[model samples]
Target: MRMRASQVLALQSHFESTFTHRLKVFLAERLPEARGALAGEEGLARLEARISVARSLGFRGERDACKYVTLSFLLGEDFHEAHWAAAALVDPRHRTPTDRAEALWNAAKQRELDEFTTESVRASD
Candidate 1:
């Protein structure tokens, strides 16, 4: 699905909130090269395009695509290539360090998952 402009802005906000200036600059340097590769042809190309532009400018990779996707979920946002690229850069599983924003997002996401799991278990029972 095509992402709304508001959603794009929100993702940008999250991206900015999650990284430091130095990391942002480093990501900016690497982003242009990874743009197309990161944003594969899929749902919401325009929204993905906007995110690619943001990453091209200076968005840091948090780890790999999967972790980024997880982070996006944790943030209560849709997954995008920029998040994946950021995740790839940080290697979220092993050595990725999270800031306060990431921590908050993660906590919220874990709570949501826990709720879902609990509901599912209760249903099965």
Candidate 2:
């Protein structure tokens, strides 16, 4: 089912807020040497690249933003690869934030998901 416009905004807002908090904490916990990387010229270039790739994904939620930045900053992956992996985690329909959420929601509602989840519930008994 297609989500309402308001629902998309609400979900994206939650995603953005959560990402901001987690990104702050993640940055804080890193060592001085690591933090310094983000402060320098090379780090700035890398961060900008990540942001660009994230924009291409067309999902403005926190996860997409964080995934791009996190992979580049922490894992040291290149922009294209990190974005591709992150894109796979979300939806590939590159247009609006609502489209991404609706694609994910529809995927979650699939028969395979229902069957897979039911097995976990049965195992708990």
Residues 1-125, candidate 2: write the lDDT tens digits.
99999999998788654554455456547634457665656755655566666667564665656545554564454533444344544544545665554443344345346778999999999
Give every collision pair in model 2: none
Mark the regions of model 2 whose C-alpha exceeds 4 Å error after superposition. Answer: 1-33, 79-125
TM-score of each: 0.28, 0.38
- Name the runs in model 1 displaced over 4 angstroms: 1-40, 43-59, 62-66, 70-97, 120-125
The number of clashing residue pairs in each candidate reads 10, 0
Worst 10 residues of 2 by lDDT: 103-112
- TM-score (C-alpha, index-matched) for candidate 1: 0.28
lDDT of 1 at 53: 42
For model 1, name the residue pairs that clash. Answer: 61-86, 62-86, 62-87, 63-86, 63-87, 63-88, 63-91, 64-87, 64-88, 65-84
CA error at residue 3 for candidate 1, angstroms: 41
